[model samples]
Target: MSVLSRLFARHVKPEFGKPGPRQEGGDLPPHLYGVIAEFGKPETLVHAVHATRKEGYQVIEAYTPYPIEELHDAIGHGPSRVPLLVLIGGIVGGLFGFFLQYWTSVVAYPLNVGGRPYNSWVSFIPITFECTILFAGIAAVLGMLVLNGLPMPYHPVFSVPRFQLASRDRYFLLILARDPRFRAGDTFRFMETLGASLVSDVED
Candidate 1:
């Protein structure tokens, strides 16, 4: 190859070639502060969450099929204020809807065809309600997606073979070593004692 071609080749990725295996190293082991244990039954899972908390693991998250109200109490998660966002969206939409109708009917084209008032409050109520609902629904969907970091094409949890069980009646407790009081080896040993079925290092 010419000098220019060789230089360009350095930046290009090779296609369909036998690449060398990756040397697995430098992955953060589990939380290094706490381990996650999965439970077969709901009661067992709930008990586990309570147990883990008593053991002093600061960070914990539980995934279930439906809303488990008691689980939040067990894990100490605060009430999410996402509904406040929907309310704000609804208020804004209602105001905008009213303004649009007012501008068009009363100011832009004022025609009293059937002896009806230009600023007809009754006529605008339905439109206002529709706009309020529309904005609230849109906000809820978008807010949830944004907060969840959705459309997540890539996630470290996917690398774990058993994590897929989350959707299928399996409960998991993830303790992030990112907490202020986390230590790796001590955390791993604690998790093992907590009856973790399979404890492997969770990679971010």
Candidate 2:
């Protein structure tokens, strides 16, 4: 074959719908957490959340110095499970306390004081109530912490210098990379087009 034809054939992509073999030892791209955008106002952050949701991005979070009630609905963020957890804990604690009291007075010790009867249901009320409240309070705090992902000393979003201001006055919105619709370049540009003052990558 002619040299010109040989060169052209060597450079041509391999046949029909089949992928060419990758380089033997190429490094993979770095992992990413997601993309984040900084906004100056609460309203703007809300707007961004709405826009992102409309764009079909489901995994979104907004950070502000103080809570914005509207954001709960904007991102389609679900209602918290802490309340339910607390209720369950309270019920369990109450049952345990009552049964323990029942077993001691009626089954094990069979105490009799002033002819008050071995099974004194009325006397157990105070301890049952106390145990219920104690367990419920603990459940509320623990459930909140677990659901909020506490003890996280590091997060990729913290890598952004301006994110420190999130607790002071600024507002921020993040779109996690796990979203099915996320494309780094496209999401970055999309966030910019929504009038964000700054946009940055969040490395995992």
Candidate 3:
């Protein structure tokens, strides 16, 4: 047996049945969407992610009950663009607020209240600060939602019965069918080799 196969064999419990043969077209279940591998620990999950990536599978995702900073690196997630969005929002808001203040205080309704300077930039600070905070806050929230594809009331991964444990104790690694390297049998075996406690199909 290959190294990977041996690695998987080491972890196979006699209680869990062997993985079934791959099916296709009419032979495949209609609900089958992808494959999920459940790991007993975060370290194993991280190792599995790295191994999967090394195998050239790009359409992979991982889930854990709590954050694992190393998992992000293992999965090769790029830096988030939310900060850039927030910065752009802040700049736009600041400019708009500053210009509005300038226009209103100097041109629209010039208050010659105390012979003080009409273009008092000091007074503009409060509104400018408020606008910057408001816009940046909105952008951070909306940008995060958009980037992360939030408000998702449903996901196919949830169809797996054991996946509910993902939010509790178990860590999961998924290999999406859309991946160029994916082959039902091959990917299933590959995940098996990563010491998965349970490897099951995900349904759409």
TM-score winner among the candidates?
Answer: 2
Query: Clashes in model 1: which pairs?
Result: 30-201, 32-184
lDDT of prediction 3 = 0.80
* Model 1 agreement with the true structure over 84-123: per-residue lDDT tens digits: 6688879988998888899999999998959999999789
User: How does each model score on lDDT?
Assistant: 0.66, 0.79, 0.80
Which has the higher lDDT value, candidate number 2 or candidate number 3? 3
Candidate 2 residue lDDT tens string, 1-204: 674343334223222223223222233235666789999988999988999999998867788999998999998966776788799889998998899999989998986799998878899999999989999999889767766666567667888899999999899999876676777677888999887899998766
For model 2, the superposed segments whose C-alpha errors exceed 4 Å read: 1-29
lDDT per residue for candidate 3 within 1-204, as digits (tens), equals 684343333223111222223334234444456799999999999989989999998768899999999998889877777788799889998998899999998999999858879999998999999999999999899878866666667778878889999999999999876566777777888889999999988866
Task: Score every model by TM-score.
Answer: 0.74, 0.83, 0.81
TM-score, model 2 to reference = 0.83
Please identify which of the two predictions, 1 or 2, would achieve the higher lDDT against the true structure. 2
In model 2, the Cα lDDT at residue 121 comes to 89
The CA lDDT at 165 in model 1 is: 90
State model 1's lDDT: 0.66
- Show where candidate 1 strays beyond 4 Å: 1-35, 65-69
RMSD of each: 12.2, 15.5, 11.4
